[model samples]
Target: MALVRVQNFAVSLDGFGTGEGQSADAHFGHAGDRLHEWMFTTRWWQPGGSGGVDDAFVRQHDVGIGAEIMGAGKFGHPGWHEDPDWRGAWGPNPPFHTPVFVLTHHRREPIEMAGGTTFHFLDASPAEAVDVAREAAGGKDIRVGGGATTIREFLSAGLVDHLHVVVVPILLGRGVRLWDGLEGVERDFQVESTSSPSGVTHVTFTRTTA
Candidate 1:
């Protein structure tokens, strides 16, 4: 069974996942980087370390992810139009060692990186992207590595099976709200687990599929 999971996604206390004015330099935004402070220090993220909390959880979900689905802003530049020179923030061998389906209107050829990671641009809708990702993932899980809007899209469509939100202790006066337009959408999620470390709390939500 292939699960559509959103893992290690960070959000502010106010539900803002990213700050406004996103750019190459201001990736998330002015104070948006604070959201991911938890993942940065995690053992799986550490360069040469071998100890940290959620090691088992991170290893099971993060490593060897068969395929990923991301929005254009997450994989490449934000806003309209794609840059040919834009490779990715993750240099050379990215963490993902599988196919990555990027949601974009404009068509671009598939990009193969040093590792097994390859970025395939999709002009299709979210549902179409999911189908492609499922095939790419084979027996493994298909992950939705997102930037708020993308996650909301899948959530609204009732396509996400599990969501892992890492709520960081911070406030970005005004930014991209993760649950901005998610009101009135009826969905049930049970708290699978929770942990507080490094001033951030990790919360996992498993969608109740009736």
Candidate 2:
């Protein structure tokens, strides 16, 4: 059976996944690369990088993933809908080698990019989109790519089976938060944590039940 997982999701110490004033130029806004610095140090990012605990977790991102679901914010910046030629921030070939469904209310045709990644736009609920992505996954897991809001939705809907979060040591003060309105969310899963040498903490939540 295919599972739904959120992997390598980085957040600040203050719980902000991304900073304020997000634009095409600043995808992560004021938070910048601070949130993802841990992944950059991993060998998975480059051959000469560290191949320690962080690398091990980063490597799991594609272990069983066949399809991805992301929010429009993760697909592009604020005014991306205005540009008809916007392929994505990932140039010609995106990192996602699977079909990607972007959640948005606007209707747009699917974009077939280089590599196996194809961008599919959909206006649907979390459950509905998961249904479509799971079918396309070919029995592999579905990755819930995030920009905070998208992950929160799937988590709130109780559709996520596993979640991996990296808490970077920094405070954004303000931006998009990942844990809002998720009171008592830990009750649904078995949570575990491990601290990295770089001061970042890796947290995993495996669903206790269906």
Candidate 3:
């Protein structure tokens, strides 16, 4: 069974995933960069290195992700416009080699990257995007690599099967919250595991059967 998972989704102590007034320069909000300091230092994140925690928690959470789905904001672009010449922020060969489904209001043709990576823009709803992403993922899991809003969309729809959250010790008084507008949505989840390294708390939650 292919599961929909959100990995390393950072959040502040005050529950803000990103600060207000988002822009190309101020991604994740003004002080949102502080939330993801842990991931950037991980050995798995290195360009060409493999030396970090050897726990199954880290390995499963960090690597072997087959495909990714994200909102338009995660691409760090201006609106729902796509230019064939517009390469993503990561450049020619991005980190992700599998297909990436980007949720957007406007539609664009599929973009094939240097590696096996392909960016597919879809105008359909979140559920529709998941269907497309599942096929692209083959037998592997589909990951929701979000910028807050995207995660919330999938969670609200009860489509996420697993969530890995890295709760950073920071407080953004007012910003985009990870759980914002998710008050009424109902789903049962269990804390699968927790790990602490370098003062960062990584928590994994698995959706419980109803």
Candidate 4:
């Protein structure tokens, strides 16, 4: 079976994955691009960007990833379902080049992007969605692309085998957090941290056997 992994997820020092007041204008809200500044500086994002530890981690985002599971927040801004022509935040060619299952209450037909990315909307639980994605993955790993809440749900369900969280230096103060209600989660995984020169910490949680 392919492993379920969350890769290159960015969070604030206060454990917030995204800031409050999310709108089409402000995707990260008050936090802005501060949380993901580390990724922007990576070679994977830009041609002239640094190829350091940050870039190394960014490069692994799509490796062997056959499918993706993301929250509706990550797919678009608030009230995206009301719009009849809302394709997604990403343009014609999305970054994801595989089947991307979007967890949402609203049901809609799949949106096929220019790339291999196809958005499948579902109002299912984390474990249920993972099962669907895993089957669609065809033996390849499933990438849990999240917006905090979705990741937390998968973590709480023990469906995640590997988690890579980037701890940014900034503090969000308020927003959706990643560690909320997830006490003692470290016990199930072998945690490791590596600090980079850019002031961001790369932390990984590999699930441990009992």
Ranking by TM-score: 2, 4, 1, 3
What residue runs in model 1 are displaced by over 4 Å at the alpha carbon?
47-57, 60-64, 79-82, 184-186
Best by TM-score: 2
Q: Please, what are the lDDT tens digits per residue for candidate 2 over residues 81-161?
A: 999999889999999999999999986999999999999999999999999998999999999999899999999999999
**Candidate 1 lDDT score at position 65:** 66
Error of 4 at 77 (Å): 1.2
After TM-score superposition, what is the CA distance of residue 148 in candidate 3 from its true location, in Å?
0.8
In Å, residue 93's CA in model 2 sits off its true spot by: 0.8
User: Which consecutive 10 residues in model 4 have the weakest lDDT in total?
Assistant: 35-44
Higher-lDDT candidate of 1 and 4: 4
Error of 3 at 28 (Å): 2.5
Candidate 4 ranges with C-alpha deviation above 4 Å: none
Which pairs clash (backbone N, Cα, C closer than 3 Å) in model 1? none
Highest lDDT: which candidate?
2
lDDT of 1 at 28: 85
Tell me the TM-score of model 1.
0.89
Q: Which 10 consecutive residues of model 3 have the lowest summed lDDT?
A: 49-58
What TM value does model 2 have?
0.98
lDDT for model 3, on a 0 to 1 scale? Answer: 0.76
lDDT of each: 0.78, 0.94, 0.76, 0.93
Model 1: weakest 10-residue lDDT segment is: 49-58
In candidate 4, list every pair of residues with a backbone clash: none
